[model samples]
Target: MTIKPHALKKGDQIALVSPASRPHSAEALARAEAVVEKMGFKPIIAKHALSINGYLAGTDEERAQDIMDAFSSDSISGIFCLEGGFGSIKTLSHLDFSQIKKHPKIIMGSHENTCLLTAISNQASMVVFHGPNICSVDRVESIAEIKSTLASSTILPPVTPSLGSFPAGFHHTSYPGNAQGTLIGGNLNAIASLMGTKYSAHFNNKIIFFCERDERNDIIERWFTSFYLAGHLKRIAGIAFGEFPDCGPKDSLSMKSYQDILTERMIEHKIPSTFNMPIGDSSLSRVMPIGIKAKLDATNGKLEFTESALD
Candidate 1:
């Protein structure tokens, strides 16, 4: 009963919505508009996409309304979040998932926006995109990946570890095995924050959970231990974590040396897992759909999509 959105077409009108925070700068937003245009789509800024209220882009209600407007619009075929900082969770209460389930459209973002993606997938039963935010996407490959995914009749490319730029502690075989399941996760901290809430992402029914974060190793362990105690580790079909943080302190680079503790837990649980895949803010990140079925070839350190996220 998954709700897949219609494939996007060239010249399809789309919106650039700021659900979390305002763009880093007006220049960055303009560049983002150019990138979307280069993909052959006409982009419009949402009504409140530029309003800023302290750290938030605007009030929670404003952000939620823009998203609702995008979903309810007939002309707009997709949405791209301006950037991820904080405040997406606040908008959840304002959204009407039942209304959204009837008018599914492609919505893409990453970082703190993961909560929105998770909620849409869980409540609306719709597929969502975890990808580079509007202000951060500056490359031809990244553009191609997102554009190609929303279009019809193409199997997204597989992520072969050998072809990716691996970061510290992020290798293909933290635990040797393979498993196939729905791709379900985004920023590790965002996912963790939703754990006790109504929007928590599913961990049961076999899932290839993927995550990325920019926190220190000790914090990672605390969160990882919490997940383990909650029985999440026992339910995952496989797991992959992206290493580098897009905006983190310098100490994150030293996190590589403290990997053994989590690695041991992976081995002990016997779950198929891989570390440091080029996901999240990594330069080599691919457009990973939130609810699609994929094969995690952990033994060989590869990820292959087995099902499309679009109808």
Candidate 2:
């Protein structure tokens, strides 16, 4: 399969579409617009970006139409999902993959956006980044990484683990081992929802998994169990668990408590895993290039790039 690489240039135009969840506040939407403006790209906001109906950005048809319009727009060099919620999957079937293939450009977002990213990667043979959404540019480091990546020529660098504390008791340490393979994963619930579907992200031997969790939701354990049952655990070579944003130990449980829950499962299956390397949804989260090759150094809790994602 021939992958069409979209070389992002400075001063290019990018459209922000809320294909999943709508912004919780007008301030959040403004922050996203501010991020795009600061990135040197002209930001185009779709009509549905501010339209909210429950958790979704809009109705399924509205969200899908915004996405299609963004891709079909000649002036837009890339499309960034504003934030992930729960409706991207509902609009996936309406996407015209062939049109996307013909007019290739970068489509990026993480969390629930994983389904769309993985499906496009497999079907369109394009490398889609699972990076921070516009709502997450509050952190200087993440914003810097995003800017550097989008402006860099021909390669994306690996992001080292950023150590920090969270109100919820976030923590990280090396696991004392290393593994390498193509990066494949996202929010556990997001990928889990694709199981048994034709759009499911395919994995094989030696795949380094990149997964993150959030505490505002209740489906963490459920999705983890689903991935295991769907045979992802058996096929993956190593795992990197990003900092679960707002998921530190609180109330009846601590961050360690939740980590313990997943650690026990990984150990039971003998799947090597690393925890709390910030990548998304954390103040210290790094920009990781999805659909690219990378190595996981569990001993030092570092993720190193094995090749140029732009290549």
TM-scores for every candidate against the unseen true structure? 0.92, 0.87
Worst window of 10 by summed lDDT in candidate 1 = 161-170
- Off-target runs (Cα >4 Å) in candidate 1 are 162-170, 246-258
Candidate 2 lDDT, 133-203, residue by residue in tens? 78856776666667677665465555555545443334353244667777777776777788889888776
The TM-score that candidate 1 achieves is 0.92
Total clashing pairs in model 2: 6
lDDT of every model, 2 decimals:
0.81, 0.73
Q: How accurate is candidate 2 locally (lDDT)?
A: 0.73
Q: Model 1: which residue pairs collide?
A: 170-275, 170-276
Highest TM-score model number: 1
